[model samples]
Target: MGRLLSKEDVLAYAIASTALSTGGGGVGPSLESVAKMYDDAIAKGARPELIELSEVPDDAIVTSVVATGGGVSPEMMMRWGGRGGRLRRDLPFGRFDPEYIRDKILENDATWCPLNSWSKIPGPDFRRKAWERLKELIGGKEIFSRLFFEISPFVTRDLCYMSLEGMKAIDATCAGYRAAPEISQSGLNLADVKCTPAVITTVWGDLLILEEVLCFQRAEEIVEGIATYSGGVAGGPFALTGKEAKKGMIPGCISFTIDIGKAILKARESGDDIAEAIVDASKGRAFKLFEGKIAEYWQEPKYSFIWGMVKIKGTGKYAGHRFKAWYKNEFHISWLDDKPYVTSPDGINVIDPKTGWGLANFWPAEWEPGREVVVIGVKNDERWETPRGLKLFGPQHFFFDIEHVPIDKIYKNFE
Candidate 1:
């Protein structure tokens, strides 16, 4: 049994996806446009089903932003093993490489520089060109999956609804943190899109001529509104603005010392009088004086000159770990008071589970990474009540991953 989709509904989805992707997609905003088309179709009274993956039309188009090592082939494996006359290619009895896995990908491109999506698109029509170029870059499908396996055993495993296809250059840093990870191919599948080995293909398996994931059957409505497209990766004005623009983009800079000094330092410290200090510091910065809600107390958390020199004079026993000494930034500084916890993969995120997205260009993590990411176009971002206590990837919670890159990779800096 399936729920029927209407043209109006599809149009709504398009509104949502495009809104979410306001910045860009590799294929000339095609995905967003497609989403809009679906919405339009729904408006026309046509129905799209939120069906199980098992029910996917065999002939439909299926592609994954996720990719496996391309060099690997059935012939090479047979030559190497010399036995196992018949085997299932889809079911790998061993490890797999996922973009999440870094070490293995290095074998293919010594300089397999990492990359992510920017609010704006960087390369050519990326969505379409992935498999062809990646296959050439590595070797081909089979061997490439093998290369990926060396990097990620995680991807090989059958996770809950979706599977991970490892991507990275040999010894890529996704194991913990890596520089710009390119999107060879990626995307999540409906958990049961196609269980049959013949129907569903893994990155490690051969690239089939045609395929599609099972339908999505989740919430009918998105709580978050469509995010407006800003621009490609670095499309934002002064993204990662060296020492100059860090303050305006993020919150809690050194200015907090005088403005919101107490709240910033009270974290993991003498929790006393810190709140009072925050109030005292706010003299002229804010248009209106706030008691505990002093806006000036917060900085963007990047390493700014004002913040570097700013130090918190300890009161009674709390002396060390002073605000001046905090090396990370204002974002990381938040973990001092509130740490994050990694939730299950089912958690909500900026990228839709069904559509899948990559790192935006110009985003902090794109260049040096280990940069704090702030999701600009979150749906329902300004709600008076946030969904849950899950603050790691929550719209309001912006910062680095536990791996210390950004929120996408980890739940919290403290977690």
Candidate 2:
């Protein structure tokens, strides 16, 4: 039977999903706003629901919804390479192309540009227009379920928003626990499920539909390029059948995110360790990676991605040691005392020690120096352990030469 979620459930999911989002998934003040939207939405009669993949009929249609463009705020980007702080001009994804950025987005009278900080970013209702456009294309086909493109507060909010339109949330995601930098990182690619007939929409009212894609790689380039120029977007591909959803999604993640949130809330109420609560919620699949104070942080916007790194000075048992992590919207690589540690497809979360909130990399202020944090490693979905999955998500895929190591094995080795 499908389960109907209460307002509290979604509130919890919003908070907990941030921790699971690695370093991305719309954390910080944005997450606070998402939580409020949930309460407000539910108060106005929205009843979000979740169902297992098995509950969907073979003919049931599943629609994927997502927003692109997660780079640091224009305010932060404006501060780059100024005064004492410095940021890398590029990484293996390729060098930052200023001329290309200028020609594509700035010259088009974009609200936010290198010279101006007035960001015309997407709003909470960003998807409404896109959804309407998609509805027009799909005709009268009732959407059986809404699939999460990734884990984040936005995902839960999208769930509630769709429920208001009568679509249930699928207890699954295209990516695993953490967010990915590319659309091609989705399990849909691994399962050979196509995501064409995709709809890409921007806040400025521009809409484009992809009747077909040559491959996942081409789709990523096309969608990301458009999003890059449009200053972020909403809308995604649809036409996933129940059988295809079962094959292309990582299931049970919604409940798992809620469980983690519930654990944290219970711990806070009982005056227990929030970090320990997270570990317990994962049923031992998560482990405390470090307890530390932010020692240094650096970030810059590149190609609609917030690429950055953070250094943490250890405390307590980890005293005298240091840890560092690198991210492209989400943390993808880490090192303990400068030795290679956990990498992508696994999670590396920097969380508030007391509140258990994820300190998002997308928002640079969250990682300011002196903030105390607890870093944790949660296991990725089992599907990511395969060769194809590794090829798509591992450290090497991000141009890092390090091998992908499972969280448990990394912890065991550290011990």
Candidate 3:
């Protein structure tokens, strides 16, 4: 007979698989990123440890981590599988430059879990929907005693939901929530996988459903469905655990393909392979569903030596790539772009406060990382960069530094 498979075994296998691909870089003793996540989990008071997969009970609750397109996604990324072209209508690829392109590439391949695999997904909600439909085949009252649950690691980033009180609740519900899955995502390095018990409710289900529905190809449909029900935000849905609206995780029943597996019972005349069905149900369906969405905005990443970087935005140390937008702040000064505004050792200078034009051969943000006095803004020639706006000797006299100027001060002119 084949060995009995447990939820813990599946999780362990995934970690092992990723490690093989990373060539021993994941969850290793020296991996700081992985370690930090563990430490953070412990500090939060959840006993997250790593251990052999064999330790998990057959009935213990397990949550799967789904990750995909690690960061912001371009229009093309949304259209996966054979249907990509048909669905490709107008995908948004925001402002592009050297830095922007590099960010997009890294975002796609960054070490992730749950949704993204070493290469591909389960085929367009393929894994999830398949499981839900499978239920039709195996109706109630006959087999398994518990419910199947799944989740994505990315949603854990919701600071509001992952509160101290929240973890305690989760820990209390489940005998023990495993801590080794995304050890890198945690602050602890030493992982001693632990498992006890876990429980979930529709409250959890509602949250997962909303998050994914919005990110799916049929977002509009999901939103409409959510509108029919209560406990939603003005424009989005949230975890249903009596929390505020969070359109992060959407949960629901997905359809499955029947032909993939034989009857639930292959032994008895009036029965099927009840044992196999129990095992299969305990795990997920041949197919799985993933309901998630990418955010509309991402933060503009600042790079420096301390960040272990150089030559970015087509200049600096790592040049050649065009500077582009990975995530644009609601507002940013296009004048400076990705280039650092450096300053010299000399004291600050200013043109006219009313005229916001001044220039310095150097900017402060460009200097090496160290405690150094930085002159705010300085001016030299007719064309200079100044925090007090700029004064151009030329006729056009362009001024775009409105950002630095105070709202009230803008109407007044200073000598």
Candidate 4:
């Protein structure tokens, strides 16, 4: 029999899950959203059960719902909103705006000669037509491709919003699944019983689609497919975020997220320091790396992820020391005084030093300058540190050529 999920348990799971979602850096679902899910479940006499993946039969089917994508700048959102939130397709030259093209050249330091003429084109509409005419005159097929690349930020922001919607849809679908007669009839035994097994996840903003549901001979195969297909740890694997993926499946991941959230709330109520409380509650699996104010930050939409960096000036006992963190959707690497301190597969988080509230990757706009924060690092499952896991989520996977180092080794001096 599975453990019945109480209202409090649901809230706890959400809090922890949210922490896990951003690698403990940002907020996940609001408390109200979590509460609503629990309330609805209770009302429908649908009790969510918590069970270990090992307990399930080998023949069961399972699926994972993982979040992807990264933060979008407010500037991009406003720019698209002003254009009615629809991507402009009427391109004589393409979607490249004059200012956008100029910025691209400047960003690249004018290595490309053709972009230098961008400023000569007057007005957005005129610039598009002029670029088109120039491309035709020069017989440059690559010109349009370059133009699209320059304007990709806008398209990325639009996709970010769409991906967010997909996350919500998954959540709703999971709720529906839990309340269905099949789940109840199966006595909440996800495995052994014949019913669809779905694992809904929360993480960065990225979109994934399953053209059709495919069956597997074993449940573990399904878990592996989801983790690999979704890009594994860096891509959105549960193990990379501290949730266990066994035989490729995570049994109590949803409940686990809620449990972490509850622990945070309990610690806060007890008047304990939030970071310390989280560490203690996790049995020392989570720890604070540094506490300070954000000194510098930068982010841009790249490909399908938000590439960014954050700099922090340490405060209190750690004052005078500087720290830096680089992120792709989630924090992937951190440096202390220019030395690699922690890398991906290990959770990196920025939280309120006082309240322990996790800060989102895209929150620099509203976070203000010099806002106090504490950087937290939580150890991930050993499985994530393996050869195959590293390939999918290691520093090299994120475009960094550095070798993978365990968090414990990097922070050994601190201990």
Candidate 5:
């Protein structure tokens, strides 16, 4: 049986998903939009629900729904001052009222929810076109649900918006617990699931259906091209059936994110240490890597991805050590005191000790010099340790010469 999600679950999932994003995906400002989405759903009397993968009928049609685009930091828009694009330069991403987000951002008239397309919000038009195209391609089979492509605040927000439209949320994710830079990095791809027969859509109402793709790499390039040209896009390849989803997707990840979120919220209310609470919430899969202050940070938007590095000077017990991490939207590599420490296929979560929110690489200004942060390394799903998984997500894929090491082996409960 499936369970209905309470309004609080949506809010909790937002905070938890951001904290687990490993410093990529959407950032903090987007949470305000999520809050409004749930409120709107309640006003409409829609109940968002989640069901286990086993509960889905074997023949049910599904597709991974995701937004594609380079995210612009809200702080960047304030600097550009409406000169770069159609978005209002006056307010940051979260600064807009719900009406403004609903009227402007959600309507695709302007940009918010991190990209110019506003596909992350899955507004009415984007939703309609995507479903129409997907249903058409699938020969009018009822698309039972929209599968979450990644674990991030944007997807969590979209889940609420989608639930209101009658799509049951599956408590699973194709991209595992943390965000990855490429679609091919997903557990689905590693499990040899096909990504073709895909649908791609732009906010301008344009649609492109890739009847077939030679490989996931080609599919990724094509999607990247569309996003690069249109500033952003939304839509995904048909996931076909529940059997395929169960085989490829990481199950229970949404529930896991919510549990972590609830833990953080509860700890905050009880005045408990947020960092410790997060580790406890992760249930031994996560451990403290470094506690420090941001010393230097540099990031640039390149090829529709946030690319950068951060240097942290340790404090407290970690004093005298230094930490460095590099990212292409998501952190892929890190070094502690000049020695390779943790790498992708493992999660490196940078959290603000003050608020327990994951500090995003794009929002450097918010986590600028002197901000205290707790870096947590989370063990990736055991499935990610397979040879095929490592080939796709390991350090080699990121141009690093080091061998892939599990987070547990590298940190081993560094308290």
Candidate 6:
């Protein structure tokens, strides 16, 4: 028998999924987008069934789905304000309200503003005034056009939706299978599965959707692509046999994230200590590495990943210590007082000290200088520690000229 997925289950799965993405060294998608996907799926009467991998046949086909894309930082968006092209900020009302311009572009009615009217505007100044008028009529608020482009791609969310769509397609076809004389009377168990005829997992912002009946065994390659394309910010492959894949791929990762999210929400509702609750929910998997204000943060888009470093000056118990984290899409390496602290494969997450919310890897705008944060490290799957796994996802693979030291070894002094 399969466990029936409820709304709470879906919520838990979404939250845990995000954590798996971030904790596994990938830049996670927005919590809002992921939650919305699960909510929509549940509303449509889609039931996600969780089954152990051992229950699946060795030949059963499985596919992976993940989100892929880096987000534009606020600074980048602001810099592109005056530039022309898709990100141009000098267009009419472009400076005042980007959303208004977006609505106009999306509008289908020709009578409102003919396409030629845009060309008729005499000059830049005239066009500006025209946009201003339109903004006034639409009650637009002041917002930069570049800011409108800051919405990061939620590939994981799309992957989930795509999986649901694929299932629906399979159901339409499988109805004929049920009528076949040779087919079992028990019918196919589709409702209890997240992915039809297989399993599904994700990394931050990237998903690989494949057909169930298809003998696509390129998951290892897909995982490699995620790491290489992200410049070593994401997690490496959990390449295993079908049974091992079911048992070892971040066991209960979805449920774990959901539990953490739920615990935080419940704590916030009851005016309890959210940070404490998060620590409790993680069951010793998560711990505060440093508490400090961000002193410096520098990031640039390199090879499709947000490559950067963040320096924080410790406050309170960790005062007088300086911490530095180098990241590629996700926070991969960290130093405490010039000694190696947390390294890749082990999850390094930044939590807002005030809100106890974990920050996403791509949203540098959210990690403003002077903002207080608690750097937390969650243990990576033991599979990531093996020789082959380390070679694929360790510090060396990330081009760091250092050995793969465990977080416990580095943080033993602090503990």
Model 5 agreement with the true structure over 266-382: per-residue lDDT tens digits: 888899998888889888877889999999888776445677889999898888899999888889899989999899889888998767788876466666799899898878788
Query: Which whole-number lDDT from 0 to 100 does residue 104 have in model 5?
Result: 46
Model 1 misplacement above 4 A: 2-4, 11-50, 57-62, 67-336, 342-415
Which digits, one per residue and each the tens of the lDDT, describe model 3 over residues 107-165? 54553322334433222222334224333333421211111111112112221123333
**Could you tell me the C-alpha RMSD of candidate 5 in Å?**
5.9
Which residues of candidate 4, in runs, are more than 4 Å off? Answer: 23-27, 65-67, 71-246, 250-259, 412-415
lDDT of 4 by residue, 80-155 (tens): 2111121221223322345654454354344433433334423444313333333343344321011000101121
| Candidate 2 TM-score to native | 0.84
lDDT of 1 by residue, 290-375 (tens): 11111112122111111211122222233222222111111122221234322211111122111222122212222121221122
Give the winner by lDDT: 2
> What's model 4's overall lDDT?
0.46
Pairs of residues clashing in candidate 5 = none
The TM-score ranking, best first, is: 5, 2, 6, 4, 1, 3
* Local distance difference test scores for all models: 0.22, 0.75, 0.21, 0.46, 0.74, 0.46
Model 3, residue 15: C-alpha shift (Å):
20
For 1-415, candidate 2 gives per-residue lDDT tens digits of: 6798876677678778878888887643344565677777788778778888678898888776434565534543342211122232112221123333434445445444344365553444554666666777778677776778777866766666767777778888788777777887888889999777778775444567888778776887777666665554334656678888888888888888989988988887899999989998898779899989999999877566778899999988888999999998889999999999888888899999898888877567567799999999988888898999998898878899898888888873234
Highest TM-score scorer: 5
lDDT of 2 at 68: 58
CA shift of 144, model 6, Å: 45
Model 2 alpha-carbon drift over 4 Å, by segment:
28-39, 65-67, 72-129, 136-139, 412-415
For model 4, give the 10-residue run with minimal summed lDDT: 144-153
For candidate 4, the TM-score is 0.58
Question: Which prediction has more favorable TM-score, 2 or 4?
Answer: 2
lDDT, candidate 3, at 394: 12
TM-score of each: 0.23, 0.84, 0.19, 0.58, 0.85, 0.59
Clashing pairs in 2: none
